[model samples]
Target: MYKKLAIMALCCLCFTDCSQASRSVSCQVITITDGDSLTCLLKNKKPLHVRLADIDAPEKNQPFGNKAKQFLAKLVYQKSVQLRILGNDPYQRTLAVVYNAQHENININMVKSGMAWAYTRYNRDPMYLNAQKQAMKARLGLWQDAHPIPPEQWRRKKRK
Candidate 1:
């Protein structure tokens, strides 16, 4: 029992001290899978899948789905971006706030442009919330619809 406890403590210490490890990666986008997801090639690592944190864009087949993907592609496709790793979601995609080489926050920009919804489930940033409000008030992008269905709800309905 004592040996097991010591081993566990060592493991905890090893994992906790990750300051030497990089939490962010600079990569070139290899593909835009969807509005909220993309694959990028890091310098020495395999292609990484990233899910935009704090936003949910429409899925293909849903309203404005293609437009959302297009918008994302225009913003980041073939561009270098910095991924601030925020860990992974249940789906195993790395959740990150992607910033373009210009330092523009692509995740928040998606919300501001009305191409994505502020994912309140995993975020409570006032900037994102405010951006959604402005987009909705201005009837921008997907907000042009009389009743834009949230991607999550749309997915649930499809599953049922």
Candidate 2:
């Protein structure tokens, strides 16, 4: 009886993680909306608007914005992507951390490459913060700007 109970518990634990991992959506990125967003076509012919989670890229008008977008495009456009859905943002876009076929985390790479800032308020991962710090130290991409303004602040200023 004890052996049977142990086996059941092990199965439950395995399925819990497996189910969450299996929830990932397989899709093709048809368009690069910006540095941190994309338009994808799911296998079921459904369209999903995805916003990269835990990172914020520059606004189109902001310095290095186009570079950020271009970088993202080079990484995923016209390629199959795996999206692990976290949730939706206020804008109703599905928030996800995208992965390439090689299993690389695209969102974190954006930070590591200095194309985007780790959205500190929403990102609790020390790896993300560490990547940002390293990028800043190396003066990559937007970090090259002596005073690069974050997208959040840039958007607020634009609103005003």
Candidate 3:
């Protein structure tokens, strides 16, 4: 009887997870709040907060911060985009990849354009990393600054 009860509980848990996974929805970019945050208008008649997956940008007060925000804004602000929701972040924001109106991947474009850096710690996309490396090699955007501080390290310094 105990074994049957355990199996039933496991099945219930699996079903719940599957249901949650199916809740993924898409959206179009209404604004780019920052490098990692944006506002997307969803089909459900709600505006969603989108946090980019696997990367974090400099804080607003940090060096090159505004530039990053501007770059992202130019790419997607007020532009139609396709968002592939990954899941909800700890802050209840939707973590997603935002593609352009043309169906091109925006994240990869940011990296390729030297507007953003590849977050090697969490992102395993080799193409993104490679693009960033190429940009760095060409001394583009933030890379052009001889003493540009990394966003992660800037955060650490601020916490002190």
Candidate 4:
């Protein structure tokens, strides 16, 4: 009886850990504000502001900014996505790598398709970095300009 009890306890522990590791959080894409920012309706029916992890899109007034917005809209607007919430940013937006219902990685795809730049400051994903480099080589989207200002630099210049 003791051996059976021990086996049961072990099984329970393994089940608990597996469940925690593979848990899926559901969220609806309420709005796609731009390449980086969006509003999501979480499983609890609460609206959440989500920032795409590992990428930065141009601001509204910046070059290719409108194209970024349109690209994101085509990818996520009014669709349901899954967010593996890494944490929250300083701005209170949930910092997450979102995936579509089809299990496509939206953040990496944006970089690979030349719609956004890989934000290396907070992300160390080598695949994303390579994709961005490839996009630059191909002169995709924002890279079409001989010297396109990075979104971060553009924001700094505007502040001055």
Count of backbone clashes for each model?
A: 0, 0, 0, 0
Q: In candidate 2, how many Å is residue 38 off?
A: 0.4
TM-score of 1: 0.86
Q: How many collisions between residues are there in candidate 4?
A: 0
Candidate 3 per-residue lDDT over residues 22-71, each given as its tens digit: 24456667877777789988888699888776566666787667888898
Q: Write the per-residue lDDT of candidate 2 for residues 1-160, one digit (tens) a residue.
A: 9997786576454322222332588899998988999999998988899899889999888998899999999999989999997666667677788999999999999999999999997778999999999999999999999999999999999999
Residue lDDT tens for model 4, 44-78: 89998888888998888899998988998899999
Whole-model Cα lDDT of every candidate shown, in order: 0.89, 0.88, 0.74, 0.82
TM-score of 4: 0.83
Provide the global lDDT of candidate 4 against the true structure.
0.82
Among these predictions, the greatest TM-score belongs to 1
What candidate 3 gets wrong by more than 4 Å, as runs, is 1-25
lDDT of 1: 0.89
Which ranges of candidate 2 are over 4 A from the true structure? 1-22
Error of 3 at 50 (Å): 0.6
1 or 3, greater by TM-score:
1
Alpha-carbon TM-score of each model against the true structure:
0.86, 0.86, 0.79, 0.83
Off by over 4 Å in 1: 1-22
Q: Give every collision pair in model 1.
A: none
